[model samples]
Target: MTSTRLSVIDEIFLRTHRGYGVPIALQGVWRTTGTVSRDELVRIHDRLAVGKLGRRVGKPRIPGARLRWDLSPGSLPLECDTEAVENIVAWADAQADVPLDPQYGPGWRMTAARLAHGGTVVSLVCSHALADARGLIDAAAQSFSGSAVPEPISSPGSDAADALRMILTVLVRSIIATARLWVSARARAELRAFATSDSARTPPHRVRKMRSVVVDIDASQWDSAAEVAGGSANALFVSVVAATMAELGSPAVIVDIPFRTGSGDANSIGMATVNIRGDDSPAVVRAACKAAFAAPVGAPAGYPPEVVQLLPHRLAATLTSTPGRGEVLCSNIGEIPPALSTLGPHRSCGLATRAIHPAAIGPLPCATIRLSTYLSRMDGRYTLSLVSTDDALVESTEELTAAVHRALEKRNLAGTPW
Candidate 1:
């Protein structure tokens, strides 16, 4: 029997959930040309229940021991909406309210609804503690490909013995982490100095309600605009988001880009930051992005994982600082997998992905980040999903949609709002 420990990032998310912060989850929406039969939806849900998305966290018997994953199948069933809906996007947003417990069981939920006009929309919501964008995509692809599901392996030793071994391992690793923590502290000081700049101040006005906008653009046009701007597709995406934030009155935008670290943990992406002005051209932003990506990817800035695991959840939360107002998380999911393009007998016409915070219903204690953008390409269309937590900048979904249009228009690219 083998034991898999939670990664540092995973531990952070888990701690955050247990502390004051709400558990964040990822939502994937796929639009099909026709209705996916109820039976087919059930089959898809069952397959996913047995995949990676199904697992939940298993806490150690003693503190200081790393958390493990309970590889048992998830207990969530296929949720089908009997009535047709006018707006599938709105329905998808509502699905976020559904509860998903990562530590107990059923870390994911799947729902399907038919469009008023035609077609079907199916959504899968997975707790961020269980999987990230890449992990969720892989789970779906594996399920659709008829791949064999691996059975969970039992632990070799007794529970108490396993816990004792893990605690001893943590003790040894904590000593090494202490040395590294000193080095990390110096680096963090430099980061804090940079963050204290006037441009990094929080934006004015605070509102609690979060709004999101989804738009679809022609893939050819998007690619052409990127080429004409002398930048790649990714550069264009960053430029658009930066420009949009700037137009919304953010002086400078600190973009957080997520890259895969080739880890099997729930949150395997390493974060890289790039600061840009609204007036920066796509080419300039491209160069900055390239440099940022080339920089080393490591643990997030905070207390070391070993140190955090030893502390209480509330204490760990107190030590971690809130993100700056100018910060914007930009995730480019790239292309949709072919296996996900077809669900049962229906082919997907569009795909939209975004992260939702179920507990963020009112104003947060601190100023929220300005915006978050998620980009994905499916079929011949590019779906650009935007979420604004700062109500001051984006008062409503209509305002965000208009801002997206203007931003894309500036780049000679146009998209239809979803």
Candidate 2:
């Protein structure tokens, strides 16, 4: 099928949809090193008609409404501008801030910057409700490749008896799980503290500006630093984030880290969100992440989204998701997928990444930090691209960015490239 109903999870995401109401966005930059091709552009445009791109469409106010990727009626212009590198990149970055129209149903937009120096900077503004960061990267690789992407396979068999047995088991266990979840000391403390914080829970009318920063670190050095810190590269990144929160003097913070399971069909993607809580210690953070993602959690692991959708919007927002869940939302898009890195004829050099939390009401995270890697020409160099609303957090963000570089240098491998 070219189209399908917005899944329960998608509907839930749309209810608090980013940019307009809820403020979640995905922005990415693909930098080319060699010649560009119009064929890649055409392939991407074609996928919008027949692939996962259709996942974006849905009717307003209805939960899990039927939606289709209505391929724009006419042909799209394949030609792009030949402009100065600075001008092109600037134009592309500016496009990331533009909001998508929820009603129109095309939840993704593409704007390109053709470098006069003989390359391209491609910018994608996508709705967070549509796909996670990994999903976005996968989509670009899949849909834009010169080769045709593999089609989705058929669903596996299911037994009614087995289904019934599982349902019964869950029914019996939910009582214990529910009780334990609320009665747990951690849960009580989290709610009590979060519910009491006025500045943190101010109503939705008080809109706070959304901001983002994209930072790149040397791939090997990143690994080396993590090894020195006694943790994984991801743990090192999270530790830096924790250090930033500490710099702000936040009292007891929460972080939501989502990782892909790679079990969904090409058209349907889902992920597991691990909320790491407690003090900002590298050991604590690494342990939490490890515990949350130790096993093979195929796509669609958690059932909370379904349950949350069943509740009224206000009640759901208050009880389960957002607001008090975390002070930051982070995703470390580990290594660049080969499908994406070599997706086309353009010899891709590096990739830039960023996420947006467009202006929204209520207290959102201080910032969303995404650490990504590129197919490097140089062994060990880093870069930073930050875009933020004019607010107090920007000041601390500057400090954190500087501190991150300093922390990397402490490992004595910042410029050594060894």
lDDT of 1 at 359: 53
lDDT of 1 at 281: 78
Q: Candidate 2, TM-score vs. the true structure?
A: 0.67
Against the true structure, whose lDDT is highest?
A: 1
lDDT of 2: 0.49
Tell me each candidate's TM-score: 0.86, 0.67
Cα lDDT, all candidates: 0.74, 0.49
Tens-digit lDDT string for candidate 2 (1-418): 3222344445445655532235555676777866557666666656643444434443323332233223332222333555546643355546645445433555667656577766777766666666656667666666675343433423222334433544455555555545765558764554455455434531333224433344555666667777876777677666665554444444344555555544342224333334443344566678877775663222112223334434566665544344223345455665555666643676556666556544344444332222212112122434334443434444444454564455444444342210
RMSD of each: 3.8, 6.9
Expressed as tens digits, the lDDT of each residue in 145-166 for candidate 1 is 6672754645533556656765
